[model samples]
Target: MKVQSSRDFKLQREVDYGTPEQNKAVKQIVADIKQEGDAALFRYTEKFDGAQVDSSNIRVTEEELKAAYNHVEDSFVAAIRAAADNIRAFHARQKRNSWMDLQPDGTILGQIIRPLQRVGVYVPGGKASYPSSVLMNVIPAQIAGVPEIVMVTPPATGGKEGIDPYILVAAAEAGVNEIYRVGGAQAVAALAFGTESIAPVDKICGPGNIYVALAKREVYGAVDIDSIAGPSEIVVLADDTAEPAYVAADLLSQAEHDEMASAILVTPSQRLADAVAAEVERQLRELPREAIARASVDNYGAIIVVESLEEGISVVNRLAPEHLEIVAQDPMALTGAVQNAGAIFLGPYSSEPVGDYFAGPNHIIPTNGTARFSSPVDVDDFIKKSSLIYYSKEALLRDGSTIIELARREGLEAHARAVEIRLENEAKGGVERGE
Candidate 1:
C-alpha cells in the first residue's frame, strides 16, 4: 500500500462495460433462449457449465433439497437458521400496506403497493458459492410477499456436476423451492422469457460475472433487474484513536474479494496513516487470496493523509464507497457528515463483514460510486406501487377547467378535450334535469 497526501491522490477504476464481442455474444444467447426456449437453454447449459441438463433434471427435486442437509454440518444449518431469522425480522419492519385517504369532497387518493408475482435470484458458482447472497436476495422478496422466488446458479461447482450443498441448504432455508441448474446469459434469458421447465419472473436480483451483468442489462426492459453491480469497495475513515491492525484488517477484507476490489483509508493523523500502511502490508501476506488482494492493493488501494477530520469527510463523500468504516474516537458523531455510503460501520468493532453476514442490513449494495444515487436491495425492491386516483363528480367539476388549461397549454388537444367533454356532459345533464 502506498501512503500519499490527500491533495495528490484521485480514485480511478475503469468501468467494465463488456467488450463488443462479449456484448454481441450475450445478445445472441438471450435471443436464442427467447426463441428456442428449453432447447437453447439446455444446449447452452452444456456448452458453458458442462452440465448435460434437460427438462427431466433441470429443476432440483425435494429429495435433493433434503439430501443437501446431510452434506452440510448441523452447525451450519443452525447458524443459517439464526441468520435467516434475523434477516426476516429486519425486513419485516420494512413491509408497507396499501393506504387510501378520503376527503370531505368525496375524493379518494392513495397508493396501492403489491409484491411482484415472481422473482429470480442468480447466485454465482463454478468456483465460488455465496450462501449469504442467497439469504440477502431471497429474504427481502419473501418479506415483500412475493408468491414465487426462484434461484438459478451455475450447474457446476469446482468442475463437478452438482450444485454446492451449502447453496442448496441456504435456498431451502430461505424458503425458495424452485432451484434451477443453469447459469450465464442463458439463465438470465430463461428467467426473463420463460422456458418449458422455468417460469418467467417479474424481476431478477443478485450478482454475477461480466457476462451475466451484460445479460441483465439486455433483458432489463422485459423484466426488472437489480443494479449491474461493480467490484466491491471499502473506505475506512479513521483517526489517531483508531487501531492500525483493525483498520488494516477491515480494508483487506474487501480487497481479498477480487483483483478489482478497492480498499482505502483517509485520516488526519500522519502517525496513524504510517502505522496502518505498514499493518496492511503485514496482513496482506497472510491472506489466502494473497495474489488477488495484492493486485487490488497495489493498483487501487491508497492511504491518504489529510489535514483535518472535516477534510477527510469531504473526501469520503466524493468517493461514495460501497462500504465505509469510521474508526474514530467518536464514530457516530461523524455519521451525519457522511452523505454517500452504501453501508456505514461505526467504531472498530462494527467491521464491514458484520454487515455482510450476520447483520440485518442487505449486503448487496450499490458499488462503483452508485451509492450516490441508488440503494441496497430491500423489501421495496420486490414491490411495485400504483397510484390510486378516485375523482368524485364534485372534485372533477372543480378541477376540470384548470386541467384543461394545463393540457391545452402543452398542445395536447385530446387531453384537454377529454376533460372538456365530461364537463359538457355534466352541464347538459344538469340543464335537462332542471337543476
Candidate 2:
C-alpha cells in the first residue's frame, strides 16, 4: 500500500454505467422476458448459467429445502439461527403503526403504512455463497409483514446443476420458501413481470454483478428496487494508539471482496501510518484471495498522513465510505463528527465484520459515496405509506379558496376546479349534510 499526504490523495472509482453493448443486451433481455415470459427466462438461464430450467423444476421443492440441512453442519445451523434472532430483534424496533389525528373540526388526517404484498431477493451463485445476505434482505421484510418473499439464484454452481446447499439452508432459516432456480437479467425481469412459474414482486433487493445492476435499473419503474450497489469499501480512521495489525487486517477484509473495492486509512501519526502500510503488505500475502486483494491495495487502497485528527475526519466525510472504523483512544468521541459513513464501528473490539454478520443492523448498505444521501435496507424499504385525508365540510370550506388560489397560480385549472366544484356544491346545499 502507498502512503501519501492528505492533500495529495483523492479516492476515485469510475462509475460503471455499463458499455453500450451490455446496456443494449440488458434492454433486449428485459424486453424479451416482458413479452415472452417463461420461454425467454429459461433460454437465458441456460445461456448464462448453463442450466436447463423449466416449469417442471423451476422452483426449489420442499425436499430440496430439507435435504439442504444434511449438507450443512449442526453448528452452522445454530450460528445462523442465532444471527437471525439478532437481526429480527433489531428490525422489530423499527416497525411502525398506522396513525390518525382527529381534530376538533372533525377532520381526519393520517398516514397508512402497509407492507408490499411480495418481494424478491436475488442471491448470487456460481462463485461463492453469501448466506449472510439472505438474512440481511429477508428479515427486515418479514418484520415489516411482507406476506410473500421469494428468492432467485443462478441454477448452476461450479458448472453443476444444483444450488449451493448453504444458500438453501440460509433461505429456509430466513423463512423464505419460494426459491427459484434462475438468474441474470431474465430473473430480474421475471420478478418485475409475472411468468408462468414465478409471480411478479413489488420490489427487488440484493447484490449482483454489472448485468444484474443494469437489469435492476431497467425494471425500476415497473417495480421498485434497491440501489445499484457498487463494490465494498472500508475506511479506517485511526490514531497513534491504534493497533497496526488490527487496522491492516480490517482494511484487507474489504480489499479481499473485489479488485474494485477500496480500503483507506487516514490518521495524524506518521509513525502509525508507516507501521500500517508495512502491516498491510505483510497481511496481503497471507489472504487466500491474494491476487484480488493485492490488486485492490495496489490500485485503490491508500494510507494518508494528515495534519491532525480533525483534518482526518474532514477527509472521511468527503470520501463517505461504506464502512468506517475509528480505532482511536477515544473512538466514541469522534462519532458525532462523522456525517457520511454507512456503518460506523468504534473502538478496537467493534470490527467491521461484527456488524456484517452477527450484529442487528442490516449489512446491505449504500456503497460508493451514496451514503451521503441514502440509507441501509430496513423495514422502511419493504413498506409503502399512503397519505390519508378525510376533509370534513367545515375544514374544506375554510381552506377551499386558499387551495384554489394556489392551484390556479400554478396554471392547473382542473386542480383548482376540483376544489371549486366542491365549494359551489356545498354553497347550494346540493351535497348531503353528513354524506
Candidate 3:
C-alpha cells in the first residue's frame, strides 16, 4: 500500500471504465438479444458461460429448486433463513400504501403507490456465487408487492451445469421461484425486452461485472434499471484512536472483491497512517485472493495523510466512496458532516462486511461517485407513484381563471382551452338549469 499526502494523491483509473472494444461488444450483444431473442440469448450463454441453454431447461424446474436444498448443509439454510428474516423485516418498513386526502372544497389530492407488475434481478454466477445478492434484490421487490420476480444467473456455477445450489436455495428462501439459468448482457436484454421464453420486466436491479453494467446502461429507456455501478470503493476516515489492524483488514475486505476495487485510508495522524500502511502489507499476504488484492492495493489503494480530521472528511466527500467507515474517538460526531457515502459504518466494530451480508441494508449500492445524487436499491425502486388530483366543480371554478391565464402566458392555447371548455360548460349549465 502507498502512503501519500492528501494534496498530492490523484486517482487515474476513473478515466477508462471499460475498454472501447468491450463496450462495442456489449452493444452488439444487447442489440442481438433484443432482435433475435431466445436464439441470441442461448448462443451468448453457450459462448461466454460454456453452458448449453435452451427453452426446455432455461428456467429452473421445481425439482431443481427442491433438490438445491440437498446440495447445501442445514447450517447454510439456517443462515440464509435468518438473513432473509432481517432483510425482509428491514424492507417491510419501507412498504407504502396509496393515500388520498379530501380537501374542504371537495377536491381530492393524493398520490397512489403501485408496485411493478414484474421485475428482474441479475445475479452473477461462475467462480463467484452471490446468494446474498439474491436476498438483497428479491426481498425489496417482494415487500413492494411485485407479483412476478424473475431471477437470472449464469448457467454454470464454477463451470459446471446448473447454477449454484446456495443461490437456488437463497432464491427459494426469499420466496422467488421464477429462476432462469442465464446471465450477462444477454440476460439483461431478455429481461428488458421479452423473449419467447422470458417475459419482460418493468425494472431490473442488482450488480454485475463490467459487461453486465454496460448492458444495464444500454437498456435504460426500454425498462427502468438500478444504476450504472462502477468498481467497489471504500474510504476509512480514521484518526489516531483508530485500530490499525481493523482498518487494514476492512480495507482488504473490499480490495479482494476485484482488481479494480479501491481502498483508501484518510487520517490526520501520520503515525496511524504508517501503522495502517504496514498492516495492509502484512495482511495482503494472508488473503486467498492475494494477487487480486495486491493489484488493487498497489494500483488504487492508498493511505492519505491529512493535516486535520476535517481535511480528511473533505477528501472523503470528494471521493464519495461506496462504503465509508468512521473509526475515531468520536465517530458519530462526524456522521452529519459526511455528505456522500453509499453506506457508513461508525466505530471499529461496524465493519463494511456487516452491511454487505448479515446486515438488513441492501449491499447493492451506488458507486463511482454516484452517491452524490443516486441512492441504494430500495422499495422505491420497485414501486412507482402516480400523482392524484381531483377537481370539484366549486374548486375548478374558483381556480379556473388563474389556470387559464397561466396556461395562456406560456402560449399553449390547447392547455388553456382544455380548462376553459370545462369552466364554460359549468357556467352555461348553471344558467340553463337554474342551479
Candidate 4:
C-alpha cells in the first residue's frame, strides 16, 4: 500500500454511484410488475430465486415460524431478543412529537406527526440469512409506532417457504407481523402495488443485491424508500497510538461485506500506516472471506499518508463513508468538523461491528457518498409529518387581510376565500372558534 505524498493522491471523482443500466432495468421491472401484478411477480420469483413460488403462498404462517424457533439455538434467540431491546431503546429517542405554534397576531402554524401506517423491510437472502438485519429494519418502524411492519426475503432452495426462522425470531422480537416468501424486484413490486397476497406498503427498506436496489429505484415515487444502498465502506482515522492489528481487523470487517466494499485508512504517521498495511496482509490470509476482503482492499482500499491530522479529517469529510471510525489522539475534537458520515464510531473500542449488531444505533445506513445529505434508517424515516392549522374566527379576522393578500398574490382565490369567510363571520360574532 503506497501513499501518494501530496493532495493529488485521490483519483478523480469518477465513482459511478448509480448507473443508467441499473436505472433502466429497475424502471422496466416496476412497469412489468405494475402491468401484470401477481403473474409478473411469480414469473420473476421463479426466474430469479430458483424456486417455485406463486401469489397463493407468499405469506409465512405460525407453524413455519414455530419450526424456525425449533431450528435456532436457545442462546442465539436470547441474544437476538436482547439486540432488539437495545435497538428499540435507541430508536425510541428518535421518535418525534407534533407541534403547534401560536402567535399574538392570531397566526397559527403547526405540524402533525403521524406514523407511515405500513412499511416493508427487504432482507436479501440469496446466499445466507442476515438475522441481525431483521432486527435492524423492523425495530425502528415499530418505535415510530407504524401500525404494520412487513418483511420479505428470498426462499431458500432447500424448501424454505419464507424467511429463515432465526430471521423470524429476530423479526418477532422487533415487532414485525407480516413475513413474505418473495424476493427481488418482484418483492419491491409487491410492496409498491398490492397483490392478492402481499399488502402494499408506504415504504420499503433494508439491504439487498443489485436487483433489489434497482427495484427500489424504479419504485421510488410509487412508495417511499429508505435509500438506494451501494457498496459498504469504512474509513479508519488512526494515529500512532492506535493498534495496527485493530485497524487491520476493522478494515477486513467492512471488506468482508462484499468485493466492492471499500476500506480506507488515513494517517499522519508513516510508521503506523506501514504497520497497518502489513497487519492487513497478515490477517487477510487467515480468514474464510479472505478472497473477498483481499480483492476489496487491493482495489478500492487506500492508505493515504497526509501531511497532518487535520488533512486526514478533511479527506474523511470528502469521502463521508458509511462507517467512520475515529481512532486518533483526540477523536472528539475533530468530530465537530465532521459534517458528513452515516455513523461515527468514536474511540478504538467502538468498532464497526458494535454498530452492526449490538449498538442501539441503526446499521441500515446511507451509502455511495450519500452520507453528505442522507442519514441512517431511523424512526423518522417511517413517520410522516403533516402541518396543521386551526384558527378561530376571531384569530382569522385578526390576520385575514394578510392571508387574503398572500393567497391572491399567488392566484389561489379559493385559498384566500377560505380564510376570509371565517373572518367575515367573525365580524358578526357568528362562530366562536375557541368555545
Q: Which stretches of candidate 1 lie above 4 Å from their native place? A: 158-161, 431-435
Model 4 spans with C-alpha error above 4 angstroms: 11-25, 101-108, 157-163, 412-435
Candidate 3 vs. truth: CA RMSD? 1.9
What are the lDDT figures for the candidates, one per model? 0.93, 0.93, 0.90, 0.83
lDDT of 3 by residue, 1-435 (tens): 889999899976662357899999999998998899999999999999888889999999999999999999999999999888888888889888999999999999999999999999999874468899999999999999999999998888635546889999999999999989999989999999989999999899887888888899889999999887877899999999998999999999999988889999999999999999899999989989999999999999999999999999999999988999999999999999999999999998999999998879988888888898888888988999999999999998999999999999999999999999988888888535555
Clashing residue pairs, candidate 2? none
RMSD of each: 1.9, 1.7, 1.9, 3.1
- Runs in model 3 deviating more than 4 A are 15-17, 431-435
TM-score of 4: 0.91
lDDT of 1 by residue, 68-111 (tens): 99889999999999888888888899999999999999999999
The clash count of every prediction, one per candidate, is: 0, 0, 0, 0
Model 2, poorest ten-residue lDDT window? 156-165
Q: After superposition, how far is residue 192 of candidate 4 from its true place, in Å?
A: 0.4
